[model samples]
Target: MNTNEYPTHRLVKSEDLNHHGTLYAGRSAEWFVESGFVAASSILNPKNIICLKIHGMQFRTPVKPGECICYTSKTVYAGKSSLAVYVKVARVSNLESIIVDGFITFVHVDEHTKACPHGIVIKPETEEEKLFYKRASELGR
Candidate 1:
């Protein structure tokens, strides 16, 4: 993992499960946005950050109790007033096997809660990062 990628962990429990006895989508979504927010807030003021959109949620594996998962996110695209974050949910035991993956966008706001520029720019440095940046840039627009 690179420095840009932030990781958050969650331990599955009964309360976090669904009728099928796997982790609930609601709970998973909560963690998804929270970690995306962290990735955004890490570079900007948390008080000035607000989530704008969460798209492309892809759940590939069912999480069961006793399974530990990681939510790793990074700012893949940064615009004048917005950032598109990419988050991947994977079991700690197998990081390459994604359990879920998606994009979350956040906007920097002024004290009046109006969108404002954050004065940050992001450029992809690797081929993989370029792919992520391309996809995220499409979302930012």
Candidate 2:
């Protein structure tokens, strides 16, 4: 793990689950996207951000209600006004493991025209970010 990498924050919501007694897949996906948003914004433009799209979602397990869901995200790649964020989710309560993992794409847009502006800056502060950028670039093509 990269020491400089930002530690993920926890997100909890009572209405995020479904009647199945387990966390809903849709809710999990949304949370994952939100996590990506948090991570991307913190690195790219801490003040303003916008989610462009959710690329894909994959669930490894189901999260339970009352369990603290932790979403960890990192800046994988950035270009102009767009940044790709990779995120992973874990269900914690008395020590549990990952329940889901995914990635989200965000575009920094001007609030007025809602168009992606030029010269958006993203600084990769760790080796992890560099490696992620390389990997993401390869996969992106």
Candidate 3:
């Protein structure tokens, strides 16, 4: 896989906040899945893709309102019909502070919404890529 990082950002607003004034989990999840979908759709037609699973999502830090959250996603692994997308969300002002991270699995489907072979193949060319690929492959098992 290429080392390119597909990025999307959202600003935390009053409507996006929880009772604690932090970003809400449901809102975060919606964006996280959208990020993964964008990453997977870059390789496969968006119309042919559907989310198959969402692996562990861990929120390590709270994001407050008015903060610009950056979501970076990458295709970590590719199988015959599925792709594992790893996503990381952090504050744009404080990149070191990761708010959440997770993996989302997407599969290519036909017009009937049945899984179909995407014929997409990815080979890791860097150590970091290799590590992510290994981790994503494990999710499939």
Q: What's the C-alpha lDDT at position 81 in model 2? A: 70
Clashing pairs in 2: none
Stretches off by above 4 angstroms in model 1 are 1-3
Residues 1-141 of candidate 3 have per-residue lDDT tens digits of 463579999999999999999999999999999999889988889999999888999899888889999999999898888999999999999887788898999999999999989878888988988988999999977
* Worst-scoring 10-residue span by lDDT in model 2: 1-10
lDDT of 1: 0.91
Q: Estimate each model's TM-score.
A: 0.95, 0.71, 0.95
Q: Write the per-residue lDDT of candidate 1 for residues 1-141, one digit (tens) a residue.
A: 232889999999999999999999999999999999999988899999999989998788789998999999998888889988999999999999999999999999999999999988887888878999899888844
Question: To one decimal, what is the Cα RMSD in angstroms of model 2 from the true structure?
Answer: 3.9
Candidate 2 lDDT by residue in tens digits, 23-78: 77877776677778777766656555777777657777766666776677777776
Going through the candidates in the order shown, the clash numbers are: 0, 0, 0
Model 3 local distance difference test score? 0.90
